[model samples]
Target: MHAPGIWGIIVVAIVVILLFGRGKIAGLMGEVASGIKSFQKGMRDEENKPAAQIDASTTVEPVAQPEKKDA
Candidate 1:
């Protein structure tokens, strides 16, 4: 099958933008950018954190159960 030409792509983009509106598209783009920045910040924060803290939190602790009482 023949791929869509440049005009086809442009028309699709225009239709999408018209349906969505410029402000809505810009807001969504802003939200996406902020989400990416937040993810990067979280990763950086994790990397900067101490390994001991991470390991300590992840360590499993077993709870002691009381012996069963006979009814």
Candidate 2:
């Protein structure tokens, strides 16, 4: 069997709207939009910041350990 046509999709949407009122649907859409905006802002902020810059002055020297003797 094939998938439902336009009418079937419309009927399902109507049922969904009836189950969850317009306000609920609108709130969900708003949340989705805010999340998108937040994601975009984070991406923009990251681009402005330098990537993994290391300072040469602060050097970490390796600790020398005494040679181990076999018992």
Candidate 3:
């Protein structure tokens, strides 16, 4: 199948806007922008975190059990 040209894309966009209204589209765009921003901030925070803290949070220590003695 042939890929959609610029005109086809524009027509689809217009139809979607007509169906959803401008305000709804704008709000959806705003939500998408905020979600992208939050994801970027989270990535930055993870990169800036201390390696030791990350390691400490993930590592598990083995527990020692008491030796059994036979009577």
Highest lDDT against the true fold, candidate: 2
RMSD of 1: 7.0
Off by over 4 Å in 2: 55-71
lDDT by residue for model 1 over 15-43, one digit each (tens)? 99999999999999999999999999999
* Candidate 3 similarity to native, TM-score: 0.61
How many collisions per candidate?
A: 0, 0, 0
Compared to the true structure, candidate 1 yields what TM-score?
0.70
User: Please, what is the whole-model Cα lDDT of each candidate in the order they appear?
Assistant: 0.94, 0.98, 0.94
Give the per-residue lDDT of model 3 (tens digit) for 7-66. 999999999989999999999999999999999999999999978545556788799999
Could you arrange the candidates by TM-score from highest to lowest? 2, 1, 3
Residue-by-residue lDDT tens digits, candidate 2, 1-71: 99999999999999999999999999999999999999999999999988898999999999999999999
lDDT of 3 at 15: 99
TM-score of each: 0.70, 0.71, 0.61
Kindly report which residue pairs in candidate 3 clash with one another.
none
| The 10-residue segment with the lowest total lDDT in model 2 | 48-57
Candidate 3 residue runs with Cα over 4 Å from true position: 5-7, 53-71
Q: Candidate 2: RMSD over Cα atoms?
A: 4.1
